[model samples]
Target: MTEVTVLGAGIAGLAAALALRDRGVSVEIVEQAERLTEVGAGLQIAPNGTRVLRALGIDPPGPESRAVHLIDGPTGRSLIRMPLGPGFHLVHRADLIEALAARLGDIPLHLGRPVAGVSDGGRRLDFSNGQTRAVRRLIGADGARGASRHFVAPDHAARWTGQVAWRALVPVAGWPAEAQVHVGPGRHLVLYPLRDGRLLNVVAVEERAEWVAEGWSQEDDPQALRDAFANYAGPVREVLSRVERVHLWGLMDHGAVPAWRRGACTLIGDAAHPTLPFLAQGANLALEDAWTLAAAGDPAAWEAARRGRVTRALATAQANARNYHLTGMRRALGHGALRAVGAVAPRAMLRRYDWLYGHDVTV
Candidate 1:
């Protein structure tokens, strides 16, 4: 039987485990945190992402819990409105974590056992708990700052993208049913209903000169976030004012590593390609990575099959980040063009994203 050791139990990590497990591979997850926790606000599982979930046979929560709607971010106008399809859904990070964690029932998940270091040549892992283990395959899903990147690409450092994002969860009753994106000069705000409309997820991004602390729990002034989007019309101000707790972090971008794998070890998710949230494909891409990695039977063949897809996804993500941070004349020109085209033919503007949202990962 093939045995795999998955590091980090985030979306990518757990998804990898589930994928391998379905193939009758013995999989164990080692997580640094004491408990499986999700701190980020909310995530949208697009059709491409949802396809991966369905392949894992992990049925997500009921439709009532994950209401889906589409709203214009800048003007708060209703662009597209509809329920989440079976192929795409909205979910809280914690809920998805819990669901994925549950699916790996009886699978050994060693929590609080941080990976201190990995021996690439020896295929050995030194854990913070003073234990060592050797495995046939090592998965580096430990996240952006985790030990995996250091082991795989120590020379490459993550670059700050001159932007900070603040996320919060407020009562859903106060928010619109549709996912709202408020675009403005040098700033953007995204909001969606989560947890059966009981909680509303808010993500606000703005260009900044300095990098703030990384991670989802870092505190920033809610008022500051509000001020950033104050000029944006619609429900943004209302949502910002209602945020009781806000977690802010600098959105960092790293150059895509040429190779995501080294010898018997490979990288997944943020560990390999940390992306800005502009495209909202971070978690979705991670899920796709997990599926692709698991589907490959041979290590060598698996790496080759996945390398291109991973690279393209990462590159596209980087491109989207640049497009999202438009400033000055460029910003004005781009927005004017979008608005002009949108007014002329709204469906044409939406069709531009069809290549992205219409992707069928199952193919």
Candidate 2:
């Protein structure tokens, strides 16, 4: 019998499996998809997440990010540029998944098994295929909608945030190694180069009364994305014009789940806290959870140690969503303040996130 069974083979699951196995614990993975594949675009791994990857013997695979440039979308004016420190990387999701999976040699990975629910105090996993399996322990890394999350923290409903985002990858060359946020009224777009500057990842978010379903696979017309950002100037417009395919999803605020542990089951990543894209700490927090959970030796204790940091990160990300979409006087004041700071004390702005980017969970 495997010592621990992890649900869902995404970043969280795979990372947990590797971390445990490397610590001399027997671990297995059960994934719904028949094949282990990451279906998304680029993600930023801040220093905190990079520390975990380095500890696991996996160097982050991508170009090192030099800075984050916040620009005014309508006028194409640069507002501020915050230089990043070492270990910040812009990596393709698929590439990171592959790296994690490759390190899980000889570990049991049961794919194509869709879990319907959990029973018998989180020990029995009921499958959608009319099969059931009993495991000694469980790690719920399946994601927000996975059975593990529902079992660990039940009765929590995610309310729509009245915002929808379109994600696409456009081919590009010679782009600088920096992440750019184009801020506009009630909307914002983030762009960064990925896969060795071969593809530029575009994530454009807009406030909408029209409700859209929450999930990454939902396809949206490229024209709709273009229309949403029609007023954006400079390279943002040029980039949107080239988007032939895009995925749309409604941003839902799951708010921190009431519990990260129950019985023999525990949650990590989106299964515990589903964050907005504003802070770019989703994957980073997941990486930290994987490492700390494996190293701590007790699930409940691990959750306690992680709760504060995770909660702060979630709140920061939510605040950023609101700040990025300011309008009218607020927009002008915010932009002017940022410009002032950038001109006089640029490094201070980057230093504001020292607690986040400097955290070393591996130590």
The best candidate by lDDT is 2
As for candidate 1, its clashing pairs are 69-179, 73-181, 73-182, 73-183, 74-182, 74-183
Reference-based lDDT, residue 239, model 1:
69
**Against the hidden true structure, what lDDT does model 1 obtain?**
0.74
What lDDT tens digits, residue by residue, belong to model 1 across residues 107-205? 899888888888855278888768888878889999988887778887887777788888888885634445656655567677778877788888877
With a 3 Å backbone cut-off (N, CA, C), the pairs that clash in candidate 2 are none
Instruction: Please write out the lDDT profile of model 2 over residues 150-180, one tens digit for every residue.
Output: 9876799998999999999999998899999
> Candidate 1: where are CA atoms >4 Å away?
62-86, 120-122, 174-176, 322-333, 340-345
Error of 2 at 141 (Å): 0.4
Q: For candidate 2, which ten residues in a row score worst on lDDT?
A: 32-41
